[model samples]
Target chain A: MAVLQAILDGLMIGGVYAVISIGLTLVFGVMGIVNFAQAEFLMLGMFVAYYAWAWLGLDPLLAAPLAFGVVFLLGAAIQRVLIRRVLKAPEVAQIFLTVGMLIVLENAALLMFGSGFKSVSTPYQTSSLQLGPLFISVPYLAAFAMSVASGLALFLFMRASWFGRAMRATAQDPMAAKLMGIDSDRMHMLAFALGVGLTAFGGAVILPYLTVSPTVGAQFVVLMFTVVVLGGLGSVAGAVVGGLAVGIIQSLSALAFPIQLQNLVLFLVFIAVLALRPKGLLGGAR
Target chain B: MNRSTLLRGLGLAVLLAVAVATPFLLDPRGYAIRVVCLALLFAAMAQCWNIVAGLANQVSLGHAAFFGIGAYTSTLLLIHFGLSPWLGMLVGAVLGGIAAFLISLPTMRLKGHYFALATLAFGEVMRVIANSWSGLTGGPVGISVPFAPPSFAMMQFKETRPYYWLMLAALVVVTLVFVAIRRSKLGYRLRAIKENADAAEVIGVDTTRTKITAAVISGMLTACLGTLYAQFQFFFDPDTVFGVASISVRMAMIAIVGGIGTAAGPILGAFFVIPLEEFANDLFSSRAAGLSQLVFGVLLIGVILIEPRGFMALGSRIRRLFGKGGRP
Candidate 1:
């Protein structure tokens, strides 16, 4: 029963990881660039959610769209002004630039918000629902629900929408997308904005449950990277499955070993997963 | 061998003379010695990083893990048993090298961000272990050497000048190794791999072996520096030993600023970055505690954007200025 409960809890937390990892993966998929600054988008999103709760007394869920909107514009602007200029440069320049952006965003947050860890005070934080020998907090359930719904909506959009097809075409071959009369540049910008929007939304959703701090985004960078790599670098579905697996392993490892040693377990598992399935479970041969 | 080479040798001799005279020229206080020692240590760390990152094209964001491993190993051995740190430091280096080897075995397969992420995870894991492994590491509070130990066997120096000279020697040794490596066939393979791994592989270059060799050498040197750093500081906390800021970003930044692939790049980078950091630290503390890091952060961004080629590139520019009769 305890094991089952741990697994359930792990799955929900994994759902949050999935949401975050998918956002990062999408950007990489479309742009052939990894934004080391993706975590800052999440950080900015958390701040948006926090301010919305404090000033407007709005629920965190409803504030996610607001957070997404702001971050989307930021992402689009970055794509237009900074990333687009260096789109043809060596990938390392992009990596360094993104790292630079990460520094800017993180320090900007520190300057603006200070180092205090703030919590988004919500009524549902304390509430939990019992299911057979297991218990689930309302916030965790809500987070899981939000993640699943978002994932489904994103999946459906990609499958059916023309914008989504253009993104896919661009991901596969930008030149081809251009040949097909799609504005590849616009598609790239939109993809980046959409990706940042997802990360920000994930941040807003998770803010009620987690602490919001200037350095909070750093905590997710490793786990999110692990998820993205394990799911296949650019595969959306892979990220979702990988995230859940990693989450369960991490939570269950706590039960098996000291909490401090739990990360070691995750690291070991990460190595094993990489060695066994380099392309990830859902990804084609990389 | 040539006019430029003769001039380079003369310049090195002059620099060596200045380094030898610096302790006497400056105050003989421990704090000054500490700063100088730390600068040399950072130079060594940056040089090691430049091997894999600069030459082998593997951006390891986890050099601190090796540094911490060295610090923990030497300190733990000395504190737990009556082991001499001189011998223990070598053991520490080996252990750090082995850890790097283990980490690289799988992670080397990962390209770009995945490779960096794997190393990052390794760094965090090492830090957590250092923090919680109370029996070995003394937990977070950390282990310290006894003050004024009876023998040189304990590796305790009576005066700051000795440590300064020792660190200077280490720096010389590190520079020699970097110069040697850059001239070797391994260095050529590294350059080729950095340019294009697939092409290097097709050309029959053992890309994996070259990368692993670079990583191992880099890890060992960094660990050796870590051991010296622990001895000099007289304390080894997990935060200080395994600090991502200290080990990863600092060394990488120096290497980046100095010249990523050049033999003299990281040394030049360390020279500028350390002094600049000290200046910023001195300036910002009274005004704002967090502002120094903010300034450092901004400077880092600006440098990457404006001058990714770094100081070594600028050194030539300076030389050209003199060559063009523009005033030294």
Candidate 2:
């Protein structure tokens, strides 16, 4: 019963994990360079939502689009100014450039917001629904619902939109995509923006349950990477599977170990995955 | 010796003289000397990183695991059994080497980003263990080295001059190792592997064994430096030592900024980066909390943007401009 309940709770939170990590995999898909600063954008999304709730009395769910919009622009600008230069550089340069961005974003947030944890007070913050022998936290359920909706919307956009086709084309082959009249650079900027925007959207939705701080992104860095690696680097469908698996793994490990050692289990799994399956369990595509 | 070799030898002697004489010129207890000491230590750490990353192109982002292992092993030994840090350093090196070997066995086949990601997770695992295993690591509050009478045995000294010299010696030793490796049969094999691993393998290079050897050596050297750091600072926590940004990224950044593959690169990088960072911290700590770190991030970005090959390339470019038409 406890194991079943843990799995249930895991799925709820895992939905958000999937949404947050999709951006990471997406950026990797479009641009071979992994944005180490991807989590910082999630932090930014949380801040945006926090401010929206505090100043405008809007719920974080309501403010999720705003967070996405703001971060999307920031992501686009960053891609143009910073990431573009490193596109052709060596892997070391690419890695460090993103790391430098990570440091900059975290410090900039620290300077702007100070080193304080900010939380939102929602009416459903402490509420829960009992399901026979199991229970569902309202915040988790709401966040999960938001993640599913956004994820579905993203799927629609990818399958139905011309821009999505162009992005996918670019990811497949830049020269071929360019010959097909798709602006590869524009696709890159769009993909980066859209990727981080989705992650920021996840950040906004989870604001009711999780506190926002400058260093909050540090917490998710390894977790997100684990998810992406498990699902495969560039595969969107894989991130969903990876995220749920990670969430379940975390919750189950919580059941077995002390709370402090929870991340230790995750880190071990991450290393094991990377060591054994560098292409990811689901196999990599774009 | 030829003219260039003689000139290089003369320059090194002059640099060594300057280094030995620097303590007398500055206030022995001053912050500047402390910064210089830290710079030397970091340079050694970066040099260790360069042996693998710069030479073999196997960029590791989790060196802090070995660093933290070194610090904790020595400090714990001191607290528990009254073992001298000198002995503790040797123990730490052995353990670090073993840890490196264990990690390398599984991850030796991985390359580039996959290798980096695996190593990163490895470092975080060490940090989590250290933080949680409070009985051993003393938890997040951190551990302080017990103050004993100023002595060489404990690796503790009252004056900063000894530490500066110790760090300089360490830098020299690690730099020598780097140069030796670069000139060795192993060095040529590593370069071949770096250029094309599969091709090297086809030509009879044991790619896995060579990579594992480099990683173990790098890890062991980094651990030794960690002991030096433990003695220098006298207080540390898992976060500070096993920290991603503080130890891992900083070491890699130093190597990258100076010149990745060169013997002089980490030294050049450490001298440039560490002092600039200290100056930034001094200038901005009072104004804002994260301002100094922000400056660090900006500087890293600036360096990457200006020259991905780092200061070594910039130096040659300037020399080429000045020596145009004078040399072949």
Candidate 3:
């Protein structure tokens, strides 16, 4: 019964992790560049939700799209000013710039927010739905539902839209896309914006449960990176599967072993998976 | 070749003499000695990182893991078993090297960011263990070393000067090894792999063996530095050991700014950036220290934007601008 409870809880929380990582994987797939600042987009969303709740009495769910819109523009500007400059440079330069951007955004938040922890509160703080002996908290249920809906929307976008096809073509072959009269540059911008939008949306979805602070992004980004790598670098489906697997393993392992060893399990799993299958579960074999 | 090499050696000797003597001459006080100790520590670490990151072209963000491993291992051994730090440092180095080797075996297959993330997870795992393993690591409060007069056995120096000299010794030995490796057959293969892994492997470079060798050596050196750091500060904690800021501040600013691959770059980087960082801290109030980090971050961005190759490349450019003249 305890194991089952842990599994249910893990799956609910893992939904958020999957949403966060899907954004990361999508950006990497479309742009072949990992945006280390992905977490800052999440941070921006949480802040938007917090302020909207505090000042205007707006619900967090309603504020999420607003956060997504603002962050999308921010992401587009980042692409224009910084990433575009390095689009043709060597891989190392691209990595350094993105890492630098990560540092800059993290510090900027620290300076702007003053390192205080903030959170959004709603009416369903302690509400839960009980299924026999099993229970699901309201925040977790809402987060899971939003994640599932967004995942489906993302899948549809990829499978059913002209812009999505253009993005895919750019990912598959930029030169070929250009030859076919698609503006690969515009596609890259859209893809980056879309990824940032996902992170923003994720932030708003999970804000009620987790506290927001400048450094919170780092903690979550580390987990998201683990998920992305575990899933395969640029596979969205892999992220969804890997995120839940990691979430279950992490939560359940705490029950079976020392709580201190929870992270050890994750690290060990990462090593094991890398050793056995370098390209994650859904990743293309390299 | 001999003449230029001789001149280079003389110049380097002069620079070392100045660094060694600065504490006594200017009496910039023990604060300067403290800075030198830190700079030496970072130089040693950056060199260790360079073996794999620079030479082998595999970036590991968690060299701090080895540093932490060495620190915690030696600190725990000394605190619990009353082992001498001389022996402790040796044990620490071995432990750190082994940990790194084991980690790399599984993670090295993943390219680029995946490998980087794996190392990061390894580091976080170490930290979490250190914090939760109450009996061994003392949990969040950390362990403090007993102070004593300068002694060979304890590796505990009474004064800052002795610590400076100790770090200098480590620095010299590490630098010599670094230079020796750079000129070795293995070094050539590492360069080949760094430049192009497939080409190197096709030409029979044995890239995996070379990367592993670099990692072990790098880990050992970093661990040695960690032992020294604990001795200098007289304390060891999981935060100091495994802190991302601690490693990133040193490696990212110094190594990245100095020149990622050059022998002289990290030293120049330590010299320039560490002092500026200290000054930035001194000039600001505690509450406003974030501004210093902001400035530092901006400086890093500016440097990256203007000169991605860093200070060494700039130095070469300046030399070329001087019409290849001998030193004025």
Q: lDDT for every model?
A: 0.83, 0.94, 0.80
For all candidates listed, what's the TM-score of chain B alone?
A: 0.93, 0.98, 0.93
Q: Which sequence of candidate numbers ranks them by TM-score, best first? A: 2, 3, 1
What is residue B273's positional error in candidate 2, in angstroms?
Answer: 1.0
Candidate 1 Cα outliers beyond 4 Å, as residue runs:
B30-33, B150-153, B314-328
Alpha carbon lDDT of residue A3, candidate 1? Answer: 90
The deviation in Å at residue B202 for candidate 3 is 2.8
Which regions of candidate 2 fall more than 4 Å away from where they truly are? A284-286, B325-328
Q: Put down candidate 1 lDDT per residue, A1-286, tens digits, no spaces.
A: 8799889989989998899889899998998888888888999999999999999998889998899899999999989977786677655556667776776688778877988999878888989999877899899899899989888989998889999998999999988889999998999999899998899999999987898999888777767877887888889988998889888988898899998788778777666666667678776654
Q: Scored by Cα lDDT, where does model 2 land?
A: 0.94
Please name the candidate that would achieve the greatest DockQ relative to the true structure.
2
lDDT per residue (tens digit) for residues B1-328 in model 2: 8999999999999999999999999899899999999999999999999999999999999999999999989989998998999999999999999999999988999988888889988999999999999998999989988777889999999999999999999999999999999999889999998999999999999999999999999999999999999999999999999999999999999999999999999999999999999998999999899998998899889889889889999888888888863664
Ten contiguous residues with the weakest lDDT in model 3 chain A: A87-96
Interface RMSD of each: 2.4, 0.7, 2.4
Mind giving the per-residue lDDT tens digits that candidate 2 earns over A60-176? Answer: 999999999999999999999998999999999999999999999999999999999999999999999999989999999999999999999999888899998889999999999
- Interface root mean square deviation for model 3, in Å? 2.4
lDDT of 1 by residue, B253-328 (tens): 8888888888778777887788777878888777655566666666666666666777777767778877863655
Task: Quote model 3's TM-score for chain B.
Answer: 0.93
